[model samples]
Target: MALKVLSALDVAKIQLYHFKAIIVAGMGLFTDAYDLFCIPPIIKLIGRIYYDDKSAPTAVVSNLVAIALLGTVIGQLVFGRLGDQIGRRRVYGLSLSIMVLSSIACGFSICRTRNCVLVSLGFFRFLLGVGIGGDYPLSATIMSEFANKKTRGAFIAAVFSMQGFGILASSVVTMVVSTIFDATSDAPEGHTPDEADISWRLILMLGGVPAALTYYWRMMMPETARYTALVEQNVVQAAMDMKKVLDVPMSQIAEDSPLPSSPPPTYPLLSKRFFRRHGRDLFSCAASWFLVDIVFYSSNLFQSQIYHRFIKDHDPNKNGYQLAFRVARFQAILAICSTIPGYWVTVYFIDRIGRVRIQMIGFFFMAMVYFAIGIPYKFYWHNHINDGFLVLYGLTFFFSNFGPNTTTFIVPAELFPARFRSTCHGISGAVGKVGAIIGTVGFIWASKNQKKDEKPNPERMTVALVLLGVVCLVGLSVTYFFTRETMGRSLEDNENEDDD
Candidate 1:
C-alpha cells in the first residue's frame, strides 16, 4: 500500500513543483561551488593582501583551500543522519543559514594580526563548508525521491549541473572584479594594492546572496513522500503531500487509508542484512567518489597554478591586478569550454545511456588523456605545444563531469534504502570530501611547490598526472565491478522495498 503512493511519484507527470524543487535544491550547489572554486584565483591576491610581497606559504594556501572541504566532511555525516531522523525540510534551512552568515562573516573577517585574520576567515569558511556539505546528501536524496523514475537521473543531474554555473560564476565574478581593480587601482611595482584586498572579500560575500534568495522556497518544500511513507510510516500524510505535488485526485489516496499491517522492515545501516545487500554498492560509491575527487579537486583548486605552469602565455613580469585578471580569465574560459558543457551533457544523456556506462566512459577517457599528457609532457613543454596540451587537458574536465563526478552523486541516492538514503549518501559524499581535502592539500606538496616564486617542474607534474591517471583506472574498475544501472527503475524497486 505504501509502495503504491511511491509508484504515483515514480510515474507522476513532471510539473512546476519538480522544477521548483530543482531550483531550490540546485541553488545550494551554486553557492557551494562559488564559495569553493572562487578561492583558487584569489589565493595569490590573499597572500599579497596580508603577507606583504611574500606569497602565502604552501601550508597557508592548503589550509585556505582545504579547510572548507574538511568542514564539509563533518557536515555530511552529521546532517545526513539528521535528515533521516528529522524531516529534510526541517533542517534544510539551517544549513543555508549557516552558509549565509558564515559567507558574510568571511568577507568581514578582520583581526589585528595577519595570522588572526586568516584564522578568523578559516573558521568562518569551515562553518560555511558545513552548510555546503549538508546540501549534498539532502538535495540529492530529496530530488531523487521526488522525481519520476523515467527522468530521475536527469533531474538529479540538473540539481548538480548548477554547480558548473557556480564554478563559472566564481570565475566570472572574480574576473570582473579583478578587471575593475586592474583599471582603477594601481599600486607601485612590487607593492600590494588596496583593491586586491577588497576584491576577494566581495567575491566571498556574494556567494551568500543566491543562497539567501532561495531560503524561503527551500523551506516551503515538504518532506519527500518516500521519507514520509517509508521511514516515518505515515501513509496518509505522505499521500496528502504527493497529492498536492503531483496534483493527483484525492480519490486515489483516501484520507483515512489504513496503515500497513506492519511498517516496512527497517534495516540498520550497519546490520548484517544491509551488508549482505548493499555493502558492495556502498563501497563502490565511496571508493569511486574518493578516487575521482582526488583527481578532480586537485586540478580544480589549483587550476591557476596549473595554467601558469603549463601555458607559456603568462607574463612573468605581470603582478597585482594583471596577474589576478589573467588567472581569472583563464579559469573562466576553461569552465566555459569544458566544465559547463560536460555537466549539461550528462544531464541530457544520463537517463539515455545509463549511469555505469557514462561513468566507465568518463574514467577510461580521463585516464587515457592523463597518460597522453603526462607521458609526453616534456615533449609538449619543450616544443611549445601548450595549445595542444590544453585541448587534452580540457578533456579531463569534460570527461569528469560527463563521468563519475555526476554519477557518483546520482548512484548513491538511488542505490540505498529510504531509511538510510541520506545517511549513506552523506557518508559517500563525506568520503569524497576526504579525497578532495587530500587532493587540495597534497597538490602543492606533490607538485613540490614549497616556495611562492618557484617555476613548474616537469618531472613532478608528470608524476602527478600519472598518479591521477592511475586513480581514474581504479575508479573505472570499481564502477564496472560494483555499480548497477538504476535507470527506468522506481526507487522502491532499486531499494528492494518489497523484499523486507
Candidate 2:
C-alpha cells in the first residue's frame, strides 16, 4: 500500500466528533458573553427603576452586580482544578446544569419583595458567573487540544469569538426588550409599567432557555484525544480516539514507542524555573487584561451615556423626548453590527498573522485613540469647549470592538501549556475581573467626582486613560520580548517540548 501524506489543511479536519467539541467549548463563551454585555443594561434598568433619585445603588444592588464576578473568581480556581482532574467534558457538562438551574431561578426572583429581589438575583448571578468562569478554562483547553497546529489560533479565536456574538446579541436583545417596555411612552416610564410592561421576568426567562438547551448544543463532542494521550497516559485509548478524529486507519497511526504510564507533573508552577522564566510575561498578560478592564469595561458600561448625551444635546426632539428604550435600542444595534465582523476576523486570521502582532498592534493603536479622545476631552472639558465628545466616543467604540479588547480574550489560551492553562487563564481572567469591578463600581465614583461644571475631570478619565496607555505599552513590549508566536502549534507539539 502507498503512504498517503495528507497536507496540513487536511490534517486540520477532524471528524464530526471533534467539530462538536468546538461547539461545546464555544457555548461556555456564549454564557460568559451573556453575563458580561447584558449586565450593563440590566444594571442601568435597575438604576432607572430602583434608584431613580441621585443615589448610589444600595448594598443590595452593588452586591447583586458583584455576585457573578465574585463567583467567577472562585469558579476559575474550582473548575480549573476539576478540568485537569476529571476531564474537560465532564466539568463543562456539570457547569451547564448548574448555570441552567441558576438562570431559571433568576427569572423567578421577579416576585421578590423590595430589596429581597436583589438578594435572589445576586445569588443566582453568582452561580451563573461560576459556570461562566469554569467555561473559560475548559472551553479554551478543549479547543486548544483539538485544533490543528497550523490553525489553532484561528480555531480558538473562532470558538471564543462567539463571545462578541454573545455581547452583540445581548445588546440587540436589550434594545428590543427596552423598546417593548417603552412602547407605551417616551422617556423611561417614570412609574413602573403594568405587570406585562416592566416584566424583567421575561428577559430573565429568555436568557435561561439557552442554559436549559446547552446540552443539545454540545451533543456530539468527545474528550480531547490529545489531552487523554498526552496527560492521561492512556496511549492506546488516546491513540484510538485520535485515529477516529483524524480519520486515519490504525495501521497508519504513529507508534513511536509508547510513552511510559506516568504520574503527573511534580513541580509547582510558581516554583518551577520553566514557569518562573515565563512569569513576567504572564504578569504582563494579567496586568494588560486588568488595564483593558479599566478602559474597555468602563466604556461599555457607559454606552448609554453616549446616546443619552446625544439625544439631549443635539436632537431637535427635546420636544419628542426619546425613550430610554429607544436610545439603548439604537446603540445596541450599532454595537452588534460593529462587533460581529471583528470576531469573524479572529476566526479567519489568528493563526496566519500570530498573536503577539495582533496584541501589539491593537494596544498601540487604541493607546493612540485614547490619546485622541483625551486631547478633545481636554479641550471640551478643561477649556469648557465641547468638541463633539460623542463623535469621538463613537470612534473609541469602533477601536474598542475591533482591537485589544477582543484579543485579550484570545491570547491567554494560546500562550500557556496545558498543565498551567487554567491557572494562567484564571489569573488573567481575575485580572480582567478586577477591571470589571472597577468598571462597575469605579464608574459611580468617577461620575460622582465630576462636579456640575460640565468640565471633564482631568484626574478621573484623562489621567486614568494615560496611565492605562502606559500599561498597554508595557504589555506590548512584554508580548514582543517574551511571548512566542503560537500559530500552527498543537497540544501534542507543545507537550512534546518537555522531552526535548
Candidate 3:
C-alpha cells in the first residue's frame, strides 16, 4: 500500500528537541544577510563623513562591497572541499567560530584612512564571508539531512528564508541607530560622528553580535544522522541517534539503509565519483547565485539607485536622514512581510509537488520579471512611470524566495549522496559567488557615467535586466531538463545509482 500523507507527516515532522536544529540553520542565513546588508548603509555614512571631494566614488566603494564576496568565492571553494572531506557538523562549528572572531575585529578597528579602513574591513569581511560561505553548504546540507522527507523543503526553505529577516533587520538597525543619534541634543563635544553620529562604524558593530550569538546556540546542536550513518555504517546507531535528536521512533524514520562509508580517514567529496555526479549542479548553483547577486546586490548597496531617484524626482528638498529612514523602512517591511507565506507554501507542497516543477516555475517567473522590467524601460527611459515598476520589482524578489532559489539551494544538499553533499554544494555555492563577484564588479561598471547626464540611466538598468533574463532562461532550462526531483527519495538511492 502507498504511504498516506498522515504517515509521511509522522515520519517527517520534527520533535521539540529538533527545533534547535531549525534555529541553528536559520541563524547562519540570518547572519549572512545581515552582514551583506550592513555594508551599504555603512558606505553611505563613510561617504558623507570623510570624503572632502564630494561623494565616495562608486568604483572604490563597490570594490569594498565586492571584496568580501571575493573572499567568499575562495571560502566556498575551500570549505566545500573540506565539508565533503570532513564531517558537516565539524565544519559548521568551525565556521561559526571564524565569524565571531572576524566580526569582533571589525567592531574594534580604529583606522582613519578610507582606503586603509576599506582594506581592513575587507580583510575582516572576507573572513566573515568565509565563515558565512562555509555555512551555506554546511548548514543547508545539514538541514536537509536532519529534516524529514515530507517536510524537507519547508524546513530547508524556512532556514534559508530567514535571510529575508536578516536583510530586513539590517535596515531597521540602522534606522534605530540613526534615530537615537539624532535624538541627542548637544553634539556631546569632541565625539563627532563621521556621518551625523551614527557613522559606518556603528553599522559594522551591529552586524557582529548576531554571529557571536550563533556560536552559543550551535553548541547545543548535534551532528546530522545521515553524516553519522555514512561515517560509521551503523544504521541502527544512526536511527537511534536521529531519534534522540529528532525525538522520534526508529520505525518513524522512512528511508533505506545508509550507504557504505567512503574510504576511512576522509570524507567522500574528496573521492572522484563524488564530483562526477554533482559537478554540473555545483557550477549551475554558483552561477545562478552570482547572476542573482549582480542585480540584487547592486540595488541593495546603492540605495542611491532607487532612493536617490525618489529624492531627485519628488522630494528635492527632503533631508537626507529623513529620506534614508523612509527608504529603509519601506524596503525592510516589503522584504519581511512577503517571505513567510511565499516560502511556507513551497514547504507545504514540495513533497506533493516535484522539485523540478517548483524550480521551473520560479525560473520562468524570474525570466519574466526581468523581461517585464526591460519592457517598461522602452516606454519610459530614465523616467519614473508609476508605482507599478516598484511593485513588479518586489514581486520578482518574491519569486526569488518563493521556490526556485529556495529549492535550488536545497537540491544539491538532498540529491548528492551523503559523502559529496557538502563538497558538491560548496562548489556549487562558490560558482554562485563567482557569478556574484562578476555581478558586483560588473554592476558598477555598467552604472558608470558614460555621459555627462549622470541621470542614473535607466537604459543601463534595462540592459542589466536583459542579462538576468538570459541567465534565468538558461537556469530554467538546466533545472527543468537536467535536474531530477530529490523529494521523498532516500540518500542511499543516490549512492546505489552512483554504483550503477
Candidate 4:
C-alpha cells in the first residue's frame, strides 16, 4: 500500500487558532480543578454548620470526596467512547452543562436533616464530577489533535496547566470569602446560621461560572480534522475544517487527489490488536497517573488537616470561618509559591527535554522529597517545625506537577490512534481517579485511626508519605520501561508506528 500523505493539519504551522483552542480547552480544566479542589474548605464549613462539630465524620467526608470521583470514572468511560463514536465537539458541551447546573445545585443543598443534606449534596457533586471527568479526555484529545508536533507537548501541557490556575483560584476564592465573612460577622460562639454556611455556598457556585462562559465557544468549535479524516473518512470535510483553522486553502489539494472509497476500520479497544500494540502504553499512562494522584489528591485535598497538625497552637477558640481562612491562606501560599510554577516549568521544558525524561525526573525527585519529609516526620512534628514541613511539602507539589502529573495526562492523548484517543485518555483518567479515591478515603481512615492527643501522632502521616514515595519510584520505573517518546513527531507518525 502507498504510504498515506500527511493531512494539512498534521504539518500545519502553529498559529492563532492553536492558541484559541488551547484557551477554550484549557478553560474546561480550569473549571475542573476549581470544582474539585473547592470542595475541601466547603466540607469543613458543612461540618461546622450541620454537625456543630469542627470536623465532619471521616466516613462522611470521604464519601463526599470519593463519590464525585466515582462519577468521574463513569463519565470518563462513557463520554470518552461517545466522543469517539459521535464526535469530539458534539459531546464536549454536555459535560460542562452538567457541571454548571450541578454546581449550582450543590451550592443550594439544603434539607431539614443532616443526612438529607449530605444525600443531596453528594448527588449533585456526583453529577458535577461526571462533567469534570468528561473534560479530561475531551480537552486533552482536542488540544493534542489541534497542536503541531513541534510543540505538541507544550500545547497539551498548557491545557493541563490550567489545573494549577484552578487550584490557585480555589485557594484565593476560599481565602477571600472566608476573610470577608469572618470580618463582617461578630456572632457569638456556637451561633447558628454562621457566615461559613453562606461562604461555602458562594464558593461552590463560583465554580460554575467559568464553565458557563466557555460553553458557547465549545459548541462553536469545528470537529477536529484528524477525527473527521482518520475516523470518519471524510477527507473533504477534514480538509475544509483545516483550511479554516490553519487559514490555508485546501481546495486545490483536494481536487488533485480524489477521496478514498472508504476509511479504514477502527479497532475495538478490547481487541487483541489493541492489546498487542497499546497495552503497555495504556498501562504506563494509567499507572503513572494512578501513582501521581495517590499522593497528589491526598496531599492537596487533605492539606488542611496536615496543616492543622503541623501548627502546634491552632486556637480552638477560633470560629470555623477563621479556621477555614487559615487553611486557605496556607494553601494559597503553597499554590502561588510552588504548584503553579511547577506546571509552567513542565510547559517550558516538556517540548525540549521530552515527556519520558521529565516524567522520570519528576517521579525520582518526588520520591526523594517524600522520603525526606516522611522519614523525619517525628522531628518535624515534635519540634513544631511548621515552616520546614511547609517547604518540603511544597516541593512535592512542585515535582508532582512537573513530573507524572502533567506527563501522564499528555501521553495518553498522544499515544493512541485518533479513533481511540479520547476513549483511552478517559480510561487512563478513570484509573487515576481510582487511585485518587483510594488515597482520599484511605487517608481519612488512616488519619482518623491515629490516636488523638494535644500533639498529633506523626507515625500515621509518616507511613503514608513514605508509601507515596515508594509509589513514585514505581511510577518512575513504569515510565522508563513502557513508554515511548513522541517529541517532534506527527500524530499520524506516532499512530502509524503501532500498525507496523
- Model 1 alpha-carbon miss at residue 91, Å: 1.1
TM-score of each: 0.94, 0.83, 0.86, 0.93
Please give, for residues 1-500, the per-residue lDDT of candidate 1 as tens digits: 33667877888888998898899999889998888778766776776677664456656767886889988999899989999889787889998898899999999988646888889999999998898999899999999999999999999999998998898888888888877877776577656576677888888898889889999988778888889988887877898888767787776655444555676676677789888878888899999999999989877423534645653224435555555566667777888999899999999999999999999999999999988877776556424545776788789999999999999999999988888889999999999999999897657765454353354455676787788889999999999998888989878865554545
Candidate 4 regions with alpha-carbon error over 4 angstroms: 1-6, 189-195, 251-255, 300-305, 309-314, 379-382, 450-456, 497-499
Question: How many residue pairs collide in each prediction?
Answer: 0, 4, 5, 0
Per lDDT, what order, best first? 1, 4, 3, 2
Each prediction's Cα lDDT score? 0.82, 0.60, 0.65, 0.80
Residue range 1-500, candidate 2, lDDT tens digits:
10111122226565675556656667677767765656545654554455432212433334565678788767777887787767777677777777777767777775535577677778788888887777777777777776666766777777777776666666666667766556655443344333432445555556656556658655445666655654665656765666655666666454546555566566666766655545765776677677666666566323434533543322333211123344445456555555566566556656767676776776676677667655455445344323354555554555554555666666676676666666677777777777777765655444333444232244565665555556557666766775666665544334434533
* Superposed model 3: Cα runs more than 4 Å off: 1-12, 185-198, 234-240, 249-276, 279-291, 298-303, 311-324, 337-341, 378-381, 452-454
Tell me which of candidates 1 and 2 scores higher on lDDT. Answer: 1
- Model 1, runs deviating above 4 Å: 189-191, 255-257, 300-306, 309-319, 382-385, 449-453, 494-500
Local accuracy of candidate 3 as per-residue lDDT tens digits, 1-500: 12221133336656765466777777778888877776655554555456532345667657766777877777777776777667776677788777767767776555677677767777888888888888888888877777677677667877887787787888898788766665662443323344452344666677767766767667666666666656545555556556556545556654454444454334245357545666665655555555555555544422445655653412433333444456567667667665545676676767778777887787788789778877566456346645776776676676766756677778878777776778778777777777677777766765666774244556666677677777778878777656777777765566554244
Look at candidate 1 and give me any clashing residue pairs: none
Q: Between candidates 3 and 4, name the one with more favorable TM-score.
A: 4
Predicted candidate 4 versus true structure: per-residue lDDT over 246-350, tens digit per residue? 766655326466755855656677799888888888888888888888888777423644655642114556666766666667667777999889999999999
